[model samples]
Target: MNFIQKEFRHILRDTRTLIIMFGIPIVQILLFGYVISTEVKNAGIAILDLSKDQATIKITEKLTASGYFKIIKNLNSFDEIEEAFKQGNVKEVVIFEINFDKNLENFNSANVQLIADATDANTANIIVFYTSSIIQNYVNEQNKTIKMPFEIKIDERMLYNEELKSSFMFVPGIMAIILMLISAMMTSISIAREKELGTMEVLLVSPLKPVQIILGKVTPYFILSLINAVSILAVGYFVFDVPVTGSLILLMAETMLFILLALSLGIFISTVAKTQQFAMMLSMFALMLPTMLLSGFVFPIENMPVWLQVICQVMPPKWFIIIIRNIMLKGTGLLYIWKETLILFIFTAFFILLSVKKFKIRLE
Candidate 1:
């Protein structure tokens, strides 16, 4: 009983410890609730209109108007189509046969070739779907226009990001959350370890101020987390050809912010836990679970329960994943993500202030 009291008193005396105790779980909960998603949107596409006939033009217009694809370029020839794929701007290529209209009029079936980049197969499948749907709709419209009894058929031209790219689709999100767990949450707990061990007192008694001590502990982890983020990105890029479309600097900056936010949250947990085991349990249940479940990092938030949906609003990683996807996949700028960035900043600032306030109070 006496030893327990002493331990409790020590924990109470350290404000940083208390902050860590609460911060990690809250972050986890929010992460699980809102950010991760599996749905596809706004895929980049290219067209090689070899036919340039009324049928081909009509189909192209319908595909673009479907809102699922954005035409980034128009290829002059089949040779240029390959170059576009290599450059990575085009995810799928639509090639119209030279005599598409004539063949359709005569044979009642025209062949179109869809060449998908295939590197990220999941997105490719969705692209195929969107493109095929547009073409099918065009054909149906033509049948109605000419009053043909559907004698003519539409051949599918689909490639890459095929039906089995689920693994690749989830790679970015999995990497983001796992690295977050290993880097941000783990670093915070490790730093707070000194508090649980009574070694924090020795450091406090030294010439080092509290801020310096914490910074020194967190610095190494910051470097390591950034490295992990980069490594994961490299694997996703070179190994998977999921090239980043946005500014590299912006991606790095957002990653740093998310890491710092998660680290700060871990620091808050350390302040509250009296032992390493408790700290770890809290981090796993609170940080890891929600991050994996809610942040759309693994599962879709739209599919979660209503209460879980409301709870996800508080998670920081959810926003981070959103920012990452926006920049990496959509190639969007800060203008598109400014609101999310502000939310992350607010979370970071709030936790930092709360932890600092608790820390100062503990000194008294």
Candidate 2:
């Protein structure tokens, strides 16, 4: 009874430990409940209507009233569509040909092209589908204008995110957070454990350099993180049917790069913290929180505030999450994500250099 009471008192005194044991689970649950919704809403769209007719205005008003879309621009010509898409706000572009009203009255088939930005393929697909449904409803209402011998039907196709499965949305984010948590928090604490038990002093006295010791500590954890990544991917594919649409080898290689970067960051944190408790706190604050919040795991980056958006760029997990989503969902190749890959590589190199420098300074 005395021993149990003493343990309870000890835990009550440690606020950080208490927060980890109690606060984090509650916060994560709340986040999943409120922020992790798959239901898309208020997708931005643009209209390039060369035909400035009453029918065009009516269809546009109907699309706006559907609550699924908002028209940001009433573009004049075809040239402005490229700029609107590049701005990233407009997810879908609806183009009506010059003689759309006349064609519908005489020819029974009005030409319309729905161009979607496939960067975030899932959102793009949803916008495409909802927009097509809105257009079809308008067409059905307008079909009373003339008695046509032939009827034209619309078949909408989702280019990138064909299935619109939640797994495709979740897998990359889960892999990023899980790998970063394991590689950073666990590795940092384990490295600090050596120092806590005086094993690090013995190793320092031996022939091994400090860099070698850090590598020895992180290498096992890095390999384990990679295995866990692969395991999660397998679960996503076999259980959830999230297909790897791009080059699997490239995905694996990019994942390895992120793991190495996270492991080096862990070692760097371990070098700064003298004890395991401090190491754990630093890892949680620096690695886990950033990975979860800034990495677009729960919230969309597009909706974040300007300052947070800038901060997100520095987070390695953010870039990796984008890369994985592009590769797995959009079937994008290196040419598409080379810039983000370069950012990850740069972060990994920086972490390695900083860890090496910190290890040397600690030894002296």
Candidate 3:
């Protein structure tokens, strides 16, 4: 208890520790929740309306009013369509062929072409989808009045997140990042700081077992990291509408397991890092980047190259993200996530055993 209290005082007295413990999580959640999004809004487009008729005009109005598109240019020619894309002023171009209204009236069909910039395949797919949906809805409505011979309808069922809200994706990733930062980076730096100041040797020589000393150093951080994790989950749930469809107890239990894994990794890092700066750098470069990038936080793992996917298999955050997504989004129980849970348990055990072996060698 005395050792734990002393560790708490040392952490509280440090301004940087306080900021890292509290400030970063809140800022990151807010930033990613509101600012980062995959949904397209007000995507610029050009229209080439050769028909100059009411049908083309009505379709154009519907597309603009849908709010997913902005008609930046009423293009005069195909040349202008190419120029608009080249200038990066528009992502899509809608072309109506000559006698469009006549064709629709006489033959119940008109020629319309949609050309999209496929440079960003995801965004382009979204833009095309939104544009086509709006156009199709208008066509359906028109058919209801005109009594068309046949109609094709699409029934879209978006499971988990019907709206495709990016926040749902980001909240889980942010929680993993915050927990990793607080548990692993802070723990590593704290232990390295003690070693740098020569206090670690004194503590090692005192009336404490090797495991006891390591536990005393990490216990305070474990508590603080749990608090931080709960805070992030609270903000994500209330502010961002992120849901925990699974049992809250299970979510928290898995979170604790992940925190333990991170703490164990921190201990291993502390054993190797002789200076606080080196520990920080090592944690940031090794743990932070993998947590953010390779863990399917920002990039989908399926999209990565085969070799990168193999590398991501060893990343703890990757499995943690899969576990949380299954629990939160899919609402699956332990049976569903047992494999990932076992993997995390193995990682935690491996790190702890390695750290213990290293600590014993250092003491000898």
Candidate 4:
């Protein structure tokens, strides 16, 4: 306990450690959550209303009122759409054919053209989807007033993320990656630095048991990791509008379990690495790459090769991401995430046991 206090005092005195431990998490969360969103809000679009009819006007009003699109240009000619696209301000162009209302009245169908700037395929796709859905809803409402032959209806619903906000997906993944990087990488480097500076030998010679020394070394990082988790959650919630739909207590508990797993992995790395640089290299290759790539952070695990899927199943971050997404997005209870929680607990115990065995071997 005294040794833990000494370690805490030492960490408090180190300004650089304090800043890196706390400041980086806040900055990274704000940058990723607020600045890098994929949600389409007030997207610029051009409208070519060839028929100056009430139907087209009503549809235009509905589109604008939906809050997903902004009509920046009312193009007089079909040629203007390419210019709007080239200008880079418009993501999509909606063109109503001549006699749009006449076609609907006589033939019960009208042609409407939607041209999207496919330069950014994903954003363009989303813009087109929103526009089409709005138009379809308007058509459905109109059909209710007057019976129409050969009616076609398509209904699309997005689950978990009704708004289709990328922040909803990115926030939990960022939390997992950042927590793993800070806890595992930082702890490994700190311990390796002690070895490099010959402090480990002195600590071994002290009255403190090996387990106590190890616990003391990791206790401060555990607390800092908890603070970081709360800070990231707060930033994600307040700034980016990411919600913890499930129990907040459950979320924090899972976060702490993941942190312990990361710290154990860090301790194991420190045991193998004699220098800070080597520990950092190990942590990067071992933790960061897998966390970012295989843990379903930026990509889906099911999309990977069969062997890669098998490999990612073993990654702690992969499970942590699943747990977080289930809690935050799906609003699932502990029942839904208990399997993942158990996997993380198992990983933490395995890493801790392996690290203890390694430490004992080193002492012997």
Candidate 5:
């Protein structure tokens, strides 16, 4: 009893330890409740209503009102349909055939083509199922009063990933998670180990700029992380059959940028942590979990709450994952992923600046 009371008091005295023990778990559970949603909400879609008749309008309304899908655009032409998916916002395009109402009225059947961006296969399946169900329900309701039973024959076309292989999604995400963990955690621990052993003070006394010191510390990790990235991509391609549909060089370049960002993040963390264990813990809590959960690795970003989605946007891994998926799965190029690339660049710059600032402050 006495030992238990003493242990409690000792644990309470270290606020950082207390936060790690109690605060993180509580926050994690609360956040997981919000972050771990599988049901997609407001997934962006386009409706190509060629007939633009009353039935099509009502069906569109039914889809929107279901709170699962949002019509981002009423696509004008078939050309726009492909571009819409490439733009990355439109997950599914619901197309109503020409004279859809007339066909349904006269022949008791109409064809509705569901074109889904199936890079994220699970979400695409859900969207197709939900949209099909709503259309079927509408048909069933119409059949109640009519002499002939109406039917909406839904033809699903899954673009990008026709086979709907889970590897197409997991490969890119695994790349993001692996790179973030290896780069950030290793770099942080390396620097923190130097600090713990009193070697960092020797380096500090040397005639080197803070930026130079940071770059020197990270250069080896940077090279090793790049190697890790390439190896992962190679394994994904050879073992998992993940395609490098886009420029392989571009993918490697983007990966290098993400690795640099992770390294800079590691430097920033080491600036605060006095020991390697603290640095490792900080890296796991701050970088690893967020990369796994919030970066849309295991879960769809659209499914998470709006506030949580905001957090995802700021996470460097989210952008990197998007870039990786686009290049590998969607065959998209830099024109498609420049914004994500720029975001990563900005994050890298921010962390490097923050690391330098913290080092300067400590030096004083």
Candidate 6:
């Protein structure tokens, strides 16, 4: 009883540890419960309504009202479909033929083309399947109202990933997760090791400025992390057949930026943590959970609630994953992913500045 009381007092005294042990579990459970879902909801879609008839309008209304999809645009021509996809506005495009209603009325059948962006193969599959079911439901309802047998057949096409390869989805996500955890965790642990051994005090007494001290600590990890990133990319390309469809130089540059962000973030964590164990746990639970769960790596972000989606936007890995997927799978250039890139740059700058400030306060 005495030993248990002593341990309980120790645990209670460390407020940060207590919060990490108790609070994080609650937060993580709630986040995962709400965010981890297989069902598709509010997936963005586009309509190439060539028919411009009553049936097309009604079908469009039904699709939008069903809650499974939202129209990003009413495409003017078939040519706009690619542009719509490149803009990342729509996951699925529904193309109605020139005389869809006329064919249904006269020949008792019509064809509807369902083109989906298959970058995330699972989500694409679910979106198309849900869409087919809704259309088929509409066809069944029409059969009941009409004396003749009316049918609407779906012609499905998957863009970006023709085979709907799971690797296409997993590769980019894994890269984000790996880079974030490795770079941040290693840098934080390295700094916290110094802090624990009292060498941090020696460094603080030296003539080095806060920014220089930070740079000196993180430079080694930055180089090592970049090497780790290249090795992962090589494995992804050779073993998983993940192609770098966009400019390799641009990809490497973006990767370097992300590594810097991770290093700076790690430095920030080390400033807060008083010991190596604290830093390790902080890095793992804080960075790893959010990156894996909320970054849209393992789950679909559109399926999550609006509030949860807002939270995901703040996570650095979410934007990185988007940039990486756009570059690698879609073969898109900066024109398409400029917004995501800018967001990442802002995050990097914020962390670097904050870390420098925190290191100055702590050391001084």
Cα RMSD to the true fold for all candidates: 14.4, 10.5, 6.6, 6.3, 14.2, 14.1
lDDT of 4: 0.81
Q: What lDDT score goes with residue 354 in model 4?
A: 93
Residue 349, model 2, lDDT: 97
lDDT of all predictions, in order shown? Answer: 0.69, 0.75, 0.82, 0.81, 0.79, 0.79
lDDT of 4 by residue, 1-364 (tens): 7877877887789898778778777887777655445458899988999997988899899999999989999999977777888898888888888888888888888877777776554466567777888988988898788967423222333322233333235778878878888888888888888888988878777776768878988898898889889888888888877788999999999999999999999999999898999999999999999998998776667667999999999999989999999899889999998999999999999999999878743444
Estimate, for each residue in 168-243, the C-alpha lDDT of model 5 and write its tens digit: 2466776787677767887787678778888777767877667776766676666656766776666556654557
**How well does each candidate superpose onto the true structure, as a TM-score?**
0.58, 0.59, 0.72, 0.74, 0.57, 0.58
Candidate 3's TM-score reads 0.72
Off by over 4 Å in 4: 38-42, 46-59, 62-68, 72-168, 361-364
Show model 1 residue runs off by greater than 4 Å. 1-168, 360-364
TM-score of 2: 0.59
lDDT-better candidate, 4 vs 5: 4
State the displacement of the C-alpha of residue 315, model 1, in Å, after optimal TM-score superposition.
Answer: 1.3
Give the top-scoring candidate (TM-score): 4
Per-residue CA lDDT of candidate 1, range 1-364, in tens? 3423444454457677545433433353334322221324557788888879988888888888877778889989877877898888688888888888888887787888777776655566657666777787777777887754333343444344233423234445655575567555665566556667777777667776556655665565566567667766775666445669999999899888887887777777767765677778888888888887878765567667999988888878788888888898889999999999999999988877766555532433
Candidate 1 structure lDDT = 0.69
Candidate 6: regions farther than 4 A off: 1-154, 157-168, 361-364
Which candidate tops lDDT? 3
lDDT of 3 by residue, 225-304 (tens): 88988898899889866788997888889999999999999999988898999999999998999999999887777768
Residues 63-111 of candidate 2 have per-residue lDDT tens digits of 8898878889889887897898888788788877777777777778776
Query: Which portions of model 2 miss their true places by more than 4 Å?
Result: 1-168, 360-364
Model 5 segments beyond 4 Å from truth? 1-154, 157-168, 360-364
